[model samples]
Target: MTDHPRSGAHDRLVTSLGTSIVTGELPPDSDVDPVALESQFGVSRTAVREALRVLSAKGLVGARPRRGTFVAPREQWALLDPDVLRWRFADRVDGVFLDELGEVRLTVEPTAARLAASRRTDRDLADLEDALAAMRSAGEKDADEQVTADLAFHDALLRAAHNELLLQMSVVIEVGLRLRDQFVHGALTTESADKHAEVLLAVRKQRPKAAETAMRALIEKSIADVEIAKKAI
Candidate 1:
């Protein structure tokens, strides 16, 4: 994303500040020291300000008259923002957050699968099949590819549901999914592929109830994988 010196500085400042804030090093309502940031990061004042503005837009920081800029309360943060999610999971998986993400997936994915069964088109089926095939072909050495394909499969399933709001919700879900995959990718087995296959098959067969059940099982398996991976870590 950073292609130039100035942008790189801005990004570095943002990433540093954001990580600090997310990790509670700069706890809520703490002052954001632009001068210190500029000196510490060797970034220009413009770069520092620009980074602050970006964080502000993401609800990570806010300014008040006579008070300068400060980190916002957690409730004010855009938790679903990709940057925030990345920061949260960048160093290590937050078990609580990961469990919360799993809960969301459990609640939404099964219903999404049911709708997909009734709404999916031939193209949707093809896309799901492609993603499934990618998953199956991804061996232990192909962790990155496995993650991408796994994400693609869920994305295809969401699209198959034909709901605009659900599609938008995937924006948030995708971030957590990627992080979880990074941790659990090594734990994937033929059974994992088989579970996804079950969902795909149900969608392909247009069996709403079966699709729902399969998706629930798939997500449950994913949650179990994360639990296992967390212990391994």
Candidate 2:
């Protein structure tokens, strides 16, 4: 039931302009002249205005009296917004961005795992098991499958926590997983599965501290691997 952007002049303008802004082709504070955009995209002024409104809602652009539209500063951007995150991943994953994602994971995920240890339901466990099984079957050879499974595992973990705020973090977590998979070649390891297994065991045992520790260890290792990959790049 999601309203995907239609493949028309307005949607095309939105996507092209949003990507350009996010990727710094249109730097922050730069004026977004509506006439220029309309001419460039071969769209009407209304279409350009509509696209600008969408970007503004996502905190990617702002309008000033007599100044027209301008790209917003990085801090003003809605980084957690799903559309913005998708646009970001459309380009090469930046190391600084990855590090910021790692910091978020470290802050939120271990605590979520701890809560899951205390409150997980049978269905949650089933989902986690299914995700783990997918990971095992996919192994390192299937990057796409592995990333999907990896995302599912964390998604299940957050849902198991039963916190609405934590559940909301699933988008950011998925983006991080995709970025990791995209940048880190041959990154999946047996130890990764082992670490996830440890988390599952601790949660099943209702041991919050152990679950937190296991999740932290897994994320720490993932961040380390990403760091190594960044160096190689």
Native RMSD of candidate 2 (Å): 2.1
lDDT of 1: 0.86
- Per-candidate count of clashing residue pairs (backbone under 3 Å): 0, 0
Give the C-alpha miss distance for residue 219 in model 1, angstroms: 0.9
Cα lDDT computed for each candidate against the true fold? 0.86, 0.89
Q: Candidate 2: how many backbone clashes?
A: 0
**Mind giving the per-residue lDDT tens digits that candidate 2 earns over 1-233?**
33434548988898888889888899999988999988898987777877888888889999889887889998999989998888877868777888999999999999999999999999999999999989888888898888888889999999999999999999998987888887887667677888999999999999999999999999999999998887876
lDDT of 1 by residue, 30-132 (tens): 9988899889999888888889888888899999999998999999999888788888777876678779989999888899999999999999999999999
Top of the candidates by TM-score:
2
Which residues of candidate 1, in runs, are more than 4 Å off?
1-6, 230-233
Window of ten residues with lowest summed lDDT in model 1:
1-10
Q: Against the correct fold, how does model 1 do in TM-score?
A: 0.91
